[model samples]
Target: MLQGDSSAEGTQPPDIEWVFCESIVDAFPLLEEEDVAGIWMSRTSLPQTSEIRGMMQSGLMLRDMPEGVALLDADLRVIWANHRLLQWAGRPSGTPLGMTFYELLHNPEIMGPDFCPFHTALATGDESSSTLHSMDNQYFQVHAAPVRSAESPRNLIVTVGEITDEILQQQKLAAIHQAGRELADLRPNEIFMMEVDDRIDLLKDNIQHYLSDLLNFEVIEIRVLEQTTGDLIPLLSVGIDEEASDRRLSAHPRENGITGYVAASGVSYVCHDVQNDPLFIPGVADARSSLTVPLVLHDQVLGTINVESPDVAAFSDSDLQFLEIFARDIAFALNTLELLVAQKANTAQQSCDAIHSAVALPVDAILNDAVHVMEGYIGHSPEVMDRLRRILQNSRDIKRTI
Candidate 1:
């Protein structure tokens, strides 16, 4: 939409002609591109100033727009702003009209250092855009377009769109995709063996360390449900001291704690303020925030992933969402390991059973048949017969012992 005062010449397409009266700029929307000629003919019928003001008051309100739009003058002072911009600046309507952009926004980080898009656009008469985040963690992508007015050579119109959720979601997806690719690249047999021998050490050196590094958590622990007792057992842990890690590895986390609660309920939990949160069960003495996400597969909770930080409110809901997604892949890995272990055990048992059956065959009967068949060849020799008899008796005794 047209927003500033400018001469009609060269402003828009020839079909959409503009007429200026009393040096005031006005823009009207066309119903159809082909009907522009008709609108020009009826320009005289356009409402007067007072009626146009009434129409603007009644219908042209910019309060409902989600984007923040601001019109700046040549001096970089705010000339006009939509309701959204006013709300963002924490100012009343028309209150920020004469304030400079830097003066209006108290956070210097918003404009950044060494470069300002609005000033650059105003100076060079070029459009520019940048992505920035506020102190409150709200993200915005600002687009500054140079608007030339008949009265001023340098004017700018800056539009800001909040993209916090979108950016966070994209980041989460990227991390999960990377993790999935890593998991897929690994051989199943290798993962199973890793689970079988020193799973904690292997996980710390590979998986858990990556997660802790990415999320910047003070502690990361993966707790799995024991097959026989259904208790959550800490199988892999990283980021804690040697003593603390030893204790965590030696014992399972209590079922009544936050980690246990998530495992029991099969849901993710986030506690930003652990000191004030009743659900917070301190894993580290200095931890002030914690997040627990259940690792589940096929409606069954296999375990939980618990992360903690020393800073209060260090983790947000977005963190929990990301962890939950990663936890799904983890659950699949754990399930695969369990299945592999079961398959290996079954194979070993079958082998043992085969050996036992082979041992149970009638060895004594086969040896006796061999001796009886040889008796005809050795008859009439008592010396050989007595020696053979003694040998047979020893064989019988061996068979009896077996």
Candidate 2:
């Protein structure tokens, strides 16, 4: 303990201290006449580290924050981080001190090499906001604002809120709507199967270009069951090559793979970790995760749609749900086309049968009566009778030719 004596002019303050003071001048009623400036003063010490931490936390209002909040120095190193921020970083004990924000987040690619949002805010004193995405498809909405205090230098206050669920929902809705538009272009007729095949090829191409581009999925395959054989056949594939991988269009029995299981059971299956999944099939090389959704309608399994990623737990529950719903739309479209095609084929066969019956009966009777009349007029010469017999035989065989 030390006294803050007015007479001690040259004494320097210690490097750090937790100071507490109370004014007692008003309490000194007995010393009203005497000068109070000469009164003695004393200082008592408290735990400096805990006291400082408490003051910092209280000033920043960091307790119980839902969004991640952090006070960053000019170098982007973490000076102070709130409880929520620490928890998001998996540092509940307040570790990760003095580390740069991007370093701690392990995602430097979210911003460019020369661009740091926190540094820009501190330098320009202007607030900035942007969206960032992690490799695991999690999204964060980031806001960086400049904070200035008379007692301290300028720092950046960075706040981050997770927006993965909201953004994904919007994206899924948009994608489903777009797919609906594309599928509406199909015209069902005698050539409906041909058009369906062509449209599926186009759909697969767009998926490889845009759908796989956004989701970062390495593999996409669509399968449709052959109505005759009841076997699943690959309609289109983006990543898996039939020749190179030695994979065929048809999936093996349920004991052979995940797709088969989904197809047979008429349900969706997700393997967040392929290495650990007992039913996971090793069709794609180095596949760490997979999602298989069956195309089903009226309690009948049509086929399966599959997607694969190289990272474990790369897909979320929303992904599986969205895909399962999308598969329903596809299944309905295919089933409708198949029914139309079958009806058209049946109608064409009925028309051909009607034509054959209408032409064969009258023609056969005319030929037989003409042959009998010719035999009576020509007196049944050996050569003429043979010709008449041959004409009758040919008339009877006309139906087989038709």
Question: Highest lDDT: which candidate?
Answer: 2
Task: Write model 2 residue lDDT over 1-402, tens digit each, in one string.
Answer: 122333333364554332222333222332443433333333322233354466667656765768898888778888878788776665666585898887666662463322566766777788887777766677777789987664346778889898888988988778776775565445554345464456556545654554465445568877887767766777767776465234443445546478777877777888999989888767678789989988888988888888888889878887787777667767776776677667768877998899898988887786879676676957647787777777777777786666
List the candidates' TM-scores in order: 0.54, 0.53
Please give the clash total of every predicted structure, in order. 0, 0
lDDT of 1 by residue, 47-113 (tens): 4445557767744555557788877887878777787867776777668368886556545356343
Please give the lDDT score at residue 228 for candidate 2: 75
TM-score of 1: 0.54
What TM-score does candidate 2 reach? Answer: 0.53
